[model samples]
Structures are given as structure tokens and as C-alpha cells.
Target: MADQRLERLIRQLQRHTVVGLDTAVFIYHFEAHPRYLPLTRVALSRIQQGHQQGVTSTITLMELTVRPCQLGRRAVAYHYEALLVNFPNLLLVEIDRSVARRGAQLRARFRVRPAEALQVAAALTHGASAFLTNDHGLARLNPIIDIIQLDD
Candidate 1:
């Protein structure tokens, strides 16, 4: 069941344009998250299949920095640096004033979290055609963007 599901996702990601990766996807790039293996693998395959451009908000880097710390400062530093160095294709979209304003409005209107809002904002700012997130709150904001729920 999972294999077929994973394959379908892999195919979809191959044609993705400016994919927006949530914090969960970033974390999986380092140590393994058993539950996220399928999603992560599909994301990676997409990158391999010419979907090289990955859009992520500054907050994702902040959130990702926290998890690697659990492994220790050195490990965190190495992993974070490695990710930045290797993924030149990864675009770090800043959560600037404009994004903040948009996020605030989305929060007021849809009641989504700041982090999720930031992700969507990044995607929109970068002209991303699709958003990759495990966050369910995105369903509410579907009218604004195309969200591909990794958890589903």
C-alpha cells in the first residue's frame, strides 16, 4: 500500500515547480524520521528528477537548527552547514515585512500557524507552483495556493 502511494507521489514531485518544503521535510534530510521516509524519498527523487529548486522560509532554517542540536552543537553545525553548502538549489526565502503582513492576514482569516503561513508566503514569493507540507492547516488556505499534503 505504502509503495504504491510513494510511487505516485514521486511521480507528481518530478514535475513540480518551485516546491515549498516544510520544516518536517528539512529535518528528514538529516537523521531519519521513520514516518516521513516516504515523503522525504519522494521529495529527494523530485530533486533528482530536475525539480532542483526548493523554496523555504528563513523560519525553516531556524526550526531545523533546533532539531540537530539534539544531536549536539558540533553535529548541528556540521549538518546545517552541509545542507546549505550542498543544496545550492535551495532558495532561502526571507520572512520579511511583506511576508509578515501576509501571514498576519492569513492567521486572522484562516487561523493557521505562523510557521505554516511563512511556508506558504515563501512559496508565493518564489512563484512556487506547489507547496509540500504535512500541515493540515494548509487545506484552509487552498484557495490561495496549491498545497500537497505530505502526511496524506
Candidate 2:
């Protein structure tokens, strides 16, 4: 937790040329998680301002929309979908064959779920400096791309 302070994260965000978003980032933002929303919003604003590039896989949209769609909250689902699609300076990486192939390898090696593997693969494929997430487990995973744990 000491290592994951907000101030240090902001500096790291400034230093990294590119970072990837995981579905949790959107989930926190949309669900207004008290612990994570502030930093997530600030980082995203910085990205939108062109401070650094942000990228995520199309799988993110699928993940983000699930609960809302399941609850018949079409507006909320649409909101999530639209936000991911139109975020400024954010690149939505498609799950092409190359990404799928890489994800398959990641799945075999890391035992991560297919969607999670795809997300990591997409970030790596896009040359992101780090993959930003709140998943504490991923912090220890030693991915090819840096995994910045927002929750420490």
C-alpha cells in the first residue's frame, strides 16, 4: 500500500508514455467506487488531455456492459459502451487473430481466464508502458507489460 500511493501513481502516470486500462477502471468509474474513483478520474483526465496515451481491448466493453445489460439497464450499458468507444486519446484494441494467438499463449502460461488473457495480450500488443489495474493478484503475476496495481 505504501508503494501505491496516489501521488506516486500520478508521477508514474506522467513518466509512462502509454498505459492500458482494465475493465475494473471503467467499473470503478461507473459504479463510483469510493476508494478508486478519484485517482481513476484524474488519470483518465490526464490521458484525455494527451498527457499519455490510454488503450484497452474490446473485451473491456463486453466486461463493462455485462451487469448493466443483465439488469435491463440498457441506458447504463449504452453509456459504458459509448464511453469506451469515444474516450479521447484512448485506443480500443480489437481482438484480432494476433491478439487471440497471444492470449492463448498467456492463458496456457498464466492460467488466467481467456478474457483476462486477451486484455493483457491486447495491452502488450499495443506497446503500453504499463497495464493499470486494481487487481491485487496481477501485481504478483510479473507480466511482460508492467502491472500497476491501483489497490496495492
* Per-prediction backbone clash count: 0, 0
lDDT of each model, Cα atoms only? 0.75, 0.84
Candidate 1 overall lDDT versus native: 0.75
Question: TM-score, each model?
Answer: 0.84, 0.91
RMSD of each: 2.2, 2.1
The weakest ten consecutive residues by lDDT in model 1 span 44-53
Q: What lDDT score is found at residue 13 in candidate 1? A: 69
**lDDT tens per residue, model 1, 28-144:** 656678877767876866664566577888787788887557657867767775675467567778888888887788788888888888778877778777777777878887787
> Which parts of model 2 have CA positions greater than 4 angstroms off?
1-4, 140-143
Residue-wise lDDT of candidate 2 within 47-98, one digit each (tens)? 8999989989999998898998899999998988889889998999999999
> How much is 8 displaced in model 2, in angstroms?
1.8
- After the best TM-score superposition of candidate 1, give how far the Cα of residue 89 lies from its true spot, in angstroms: 2.3
Give candidate 1's error at residue 72 in angstroms. 3.7
